[model samples]
Target chain A: MKILAVDDEPLVLRLLDATLNGLGYHNTSFATTAAQALHLLESSKSPYSCILLDIRMPGMDGIELCQQIRRMPAYKTTPIIMLTSLAEKEYIDESFASGATDYMNKPVDATELAARLRVARLIQNEYQRSAHLEELNRAQIEGFQPMAPFDFAEPVQIDDVSRVVNSRAMENYLRQLDRLGLFKIGVIGFQIRHAGSLHAANAPEEFYGILADVAESISENTREVNALIAYLGKGSFAAVVPRASQIDRRDLEAGIAATLYEFELADLVDSTSDIKVSVGTQINGSVFGNTPDKMIDLAVRSAQGMTESKPKALAARIWSLAG
Target chain B: MINSQETAASHLAAALAEIRARFINDLIPLINEMEYQRVAMTDPALAPEAFSSLQHASHKISGMAGSVGFPELGDHAARLDVTFTKLLRAPYDHAGVQAALDPLEAFLSLMEDILDEVL
Candidate 1:
C-alpha cells in the first residue's frame, strides 16, 4: 500500500521508515516539511492509501497539513495517522478536530504501528467504496426502500435519539465501552422519580415521548460537551461522556440539570424530584463488576437515593417558579 | 543457521534495545533542562517561559517514553506535564507548584538508577 511519512526529525523519520519496512510496508514516501508533503500529495500519481505524520514540524505542522489534505477532494476519504511526541489531550483533540482518523503515540512500536495501519487501511477502503457508490448515483444511497415506521413497534435506533436509547441498548453500550479498556468515561445517571406513574399516560409511547423531550433538552444544551445520552428504563437515563478527564462531570451535570430545571422538567415526568444527576467517574470494566446490569442497578440505586435525599427540591423549585 | 523470521525478530529486538538506551540518555538532558526551568520558575519574572519549556519537555517524554520501555517514566512525566500545564494556567500558584515538584523530583532520582541499568 502507498503511504506517506512526514516528520522534521531525521532520527524519527529514519525510525518510522525502518519500522514500516520491517512490517513489510515498503511502498512508503517521505517528506520533512508540511509544504514538501503537500507537494508530494499533489504530485503523486496514485492516491496514497494511508498517511503517517508527526504533529510538530519546521513549517506548517502536521495538524494544518491534515486539515489541508482533508480539504482536498482526492484525499477526503484517505486515512491519516498522527504519529507524534506531542501526546497531550489538546494536541490529540486538535488532531481529531482537524479530521485525523487514528493517532499513535511515538516512538511507535512496530507491531502496534502495523496493526493501526491495517485498521486504517480497512476503514479507508470502506470509506472510498461508499464515496464511489455515491459518485455512481445519488440513487445508490436513496434507492433502498425505507423501513416502515413502527406501528407502535419498530426496532429502536440507538444512535440519534428522538428519545434516549432503551434500557438494554444503554447497558450494551456501557459494557462495550468498559470492555474496550477505555476507563476515562463518565456516566451521568438521571432517575425519573415516578416511572410507574407513567403507566397512566395512554401507552408506553407517551411516557417515552416525555423522556424524548427531556433528552432533547439535554442534547441541545450539552452539544459542546459531546456526550451520548441513553435511557436505562425503570426511571433511569444516563449520559456517558467520553474523555471524562478533560470534562468536568459536575459542570456537565449542572448544565444538564439547569436545562432540565429551566424547562420545568416536572411538566414532562409529572413528579418533581429535580433530576439529581448521579455522576459515575470510574467506568473501567472492573467498576460496576463489568456488567451493564450492575451499572443499571447502581443507576437505579442512585435515582432512589436522590428521591430520599432531596424530597422537596423539585416541588419547591417548581412552586417558586410559579409564584 | 537461524531462519529469516528469527533474524528479523532479533533485529527488531536490537533496534528496540538501542531506542531504550537512547530514551534513557535523552531523559537526562530533558530532566536537567526541566530542573533549570524549575529554578527559573521560582523567579516570578521568568516563571512563564520556564513553565512552558518544562511542560513541552515533559509532554515529549510522556508521549513516547512508555512505548520505549519506560512506562513508569512516562507516567511520572505525564504528571509533570499536567502539573506544568496547571501552573501555566495559574502562574501565581507557587505553593501548588512546589507540591507538584516533589513527585517529579522523586521520579528523576529514580530514573538515574534505571538509566544505569538501561545504559
Candidate 2:
C-alpha cells in the first residue's frame, strides 16, 4: 500500500523508511512539515492508503493536519495514525477527536508497527469493498432494485456525527488508554428498542438516517462529559467516558427519548417513528481485570439484557397522550 | 530464496546500524544546545523558553533513541521531557526550576557517555 509519513525529525523519517522497506512496504513518501504533507496529498496522482503523522510539529501540528485531511473528500476515512512520543492523555484524546484512526507511541518497534499496518490494511480493504459495492448499487439502480451496500447487522461508520468515531478507532483509543494506565473510564451501551423491526420496515437510507439521528442525540446528551461514542453494529452504540462523570442510566434514556421525540415532531424522522432507546448501566474499567474489548462487550451485553418492556409501555403511553 | 531472505535481513541491519550511528553523531550538537538551555534556565526570564526548548529536544530524543537501540537514553530523555513539560506548564521561580532540573546534569553526562562510546 502507498504510505505517507510526516515527521520533522530526519532520523525518524529515515528509520521509518528503512523499517517500512524491510517490512515490504517500499512505496512510502516522507514530508517534514504539515504544509508539505498537504501539498503532497493534493498533488499526488493516486490516493495514499495510510498516513503516519507526528503529533508535535513546528507549524500546523498533526492534530490540525489530521482535521484538515479529514475535510478533504478523498481522505475522510483514510487510516491516519498518530505516531508520536506524546503519551499524555490529552494528546490521545485530541488526536482521536481530530479523526485519527490510531495513535502509536514513538520509539517505534518493528513488530508493533507491523501489527498496526496490518490493521490499516484491513481497514483499507473494507473501504475498497464498500466502494465496489457502492458502484454495484449505482449500476443496478436503473435495472433492478439496488442492493443495500451494507448488511443490516454491520456497524457502518456514521459520518458527520460529532464525537462519534468508527468502532475500530474507538477500540484503539480504549486500548491506548489501557496501555497508558488510564483505567478510570466507563463504558455504556445504548440500543434501539426495536431495531430489527425498524430495519425491516425502513429503507436502507432511512435506517441510516435513524442511526445518525440516534448518534446525534447520544452525542448531545453526553456533551457535558468527555465521551467517545461508537456504533457497534446491530443498532447498539458504546460510549467511553471519564469515570468521574456521573451518568444516570434513566437520565440518559430520557434525554435521548426527548431528542428523538423532537426529531419526530420536526419530521426529521418518518411519521410512523416510535423510536426509543434503552441505556445500559456504566461498566467501569478497573486496573486489574477488565480489558478494553471486554469492557465494550460487557457494556453491550448489559444494554442487550435490558428488557424493552418498560420502554414499550412508556412509548405506548406517550403515543396515547399524543393522540 | 533463503539466501535472498538472509541478504535482505543483513542489508536492513546494516542500514539500521548506519542510521543509529548517524543519530548518535547528531546528538552531540543537540546535547550542546540542551546544555546551553540548562544554563539559561538559571535566569527567570529565560527559564520558560529554556524549559520549552529542553522539553522539545528531550521529547525528540526520548522518541528516537530507543528505536535506534539506546533504550536507556530514551528512558532518561523521556523523564527529562516530563520534568521540563511540568516546569513549563506551572509558574516556577528560578530556584524551584533549578531544583526540578537537578537531574539534567546526570542526563547530560549519560548523553556524553553514549557519544564518547560511539565516537
Candidate 3:
C-alpha cells in the first residue's frame, strides 16, 4: 500500500523510512514540511493508502494541515496517523479533533508501525467493502418496508444518546410550528453529508458517537434560543431555534456551524464534516405554511444548495485573514 | 542461515541492542538542552522560558523513551512534563513556583537515576 510520511526532521524521516522498510512497508513517500505534503497530495494521480503526519511541522503544523486535508473531498476519510514526539493530552486531542485516525509516539517501533499501517489500511478497505454489500442488500430487498419512526411516551432523557427526532416526530413538531403562527417558531435542518459512506465502514458505536456529539453540541449552542433538535433519518438533523427578537438567519447559522465543528470531526471521518445547515424562518407575519414533511423538504432544499459546493457551504458567513 | 525463528529472534535481539546503544548516545544532547532549561526553570527571572523548554524536553522524552524499552522512563518524563505545564500556567509567585519546582525537581531526580542506570 502507498503511504505519505511528513516530518520536518530529516533524522526522524530517515528513522521512519528505515522502520517502514524493516517492516516491509515499501511504497512510501516523504514530505519535510506541511506545505510540501499538501503540494504532493494535490498533485498525486492516485490517492495514497494512508498518511503518517508529524504534528510539529514548520509552516502549517500537522493539525492545520490535517484540517485543510479533511476539507478536501478526495482524502476526507483517508487514514491519517500522526507520528510525532508531541504526546501531550491537548496535542493528541487537537490531532484527533483535526481528523487524525491514529496517533503514534515518536521513535516509532518498526514492528508496531508496520502492524498499525496494515490494520489501518485493512479497516478502511473493509469499511468500503461492507458499505457496498450493505447498499446491494438494501437494493435487493423485495417490497421492503421502511422502519417506523420511534415513539416516546416520556420526554427523551437528558442522557439519552439519540438527539434528532425521527421523521414522524419532525412532522409532528412542524405541525406545532405551523399552528403557533408565523414568527413564533422556526426550523433549521442539518444534513450529515455522505452519511451512507460514514455508516459504510464504521461500527455502529462510531456512527452513534457522532450522532450523540452532534446532539450534545446543538443542545449546548442553542440553549439560549431553546432549539428543539431532532434526528431525521438518512443523515439529516434538524433544530428549531426560536427568536424572541428578530433573529438574523446568519446568527442561527453561525451558532450552529461553530457548535457543529466543535464536536464535528473529533472522531468522525472528514466527509462527516461536510454537514450542511439550512434555515426556515417565520417572520413579518409570513408563516411558513407547509406540512411538517414539506417544511423539512424545503429545509433540505436550502441545505442542498450548500452541499453542491461542500465544506464552504457549511456556514453562511465566514471571515478569513487576507493573505 | 538466520532463517529459523530462533535465529530471527537472535537477530532481533542484536538489532535492538544496536538501537539501544544509539539511543544512549543520542540522549546526551537532549539532557544538555534540558540542563539549560532547568537553569531557567529554577531561576525566577528565567523561569518562564526554561519552564517551557523543560516541559518540551520532557515531552520529547515521554514520546521517545517507551519505544526504547523504557516505559517507566517515559512515564516519569510525562509526569514531569505535566508538572512544568501546571507550573507555567499557575499564578506565578514564589510559593507557587516552589510547589511546582518540588515536583519538577523530583522528576528530574528520577530521570537522573534512570539515566545513571542506562549509562
Highest lDDT scorer: 2
- Model 2, A62-105: lDDT tens digits are 99999999877678778999999888888998898789999999
Tell me the spans in candidate 2 whose CA falls farther than 4 Å from its real position. Answer: A131-149, A265-272, A308-323, B93-96
lDDT, model 3, position A98: 61
lDDT of each: 0.63, 0.85, 0.61
Q: Model 3, B111: alpha-carbon shift in Å?
A: 4.4
Best candidate, TM-score-wise? 2
Q: How many pairs collide in each candidate, listed in order?
A: 0, 0, 5
Q: Is candidate 2 or candidate 3 better by TM-score?
A: 2
Write the number of the candidate with greater DockQ, choosing between 1 and 2. Answer: 2
Positional deviation of A274 in candidate 1, in angstroms?
34
Residue range with the least summed lDDT across 10 consecutive positions in model 3 chain A: A149-158
**How far does residue B87 in candidate 2 sit from its true spot (Å)?**
2.6
- Over A1-323, each residue of candidate 3 has an lDDT whose tens digit, in order, gives 88999987654565566566556566889999988999999999997879989876557999899888876666655788877765554565456546666767665777768767876777468535654323323432332433122212211112233233333334434453354343355556665556667666565445555556666666665666655566655556666554354555555555555666665553213534444344444222135455556656666556544523333443434322111
Better of 1 and 3 by TM-score: 1
Better of 1 and 2 by lDDT: 2
Extract clashing residue pairs from model 2: none
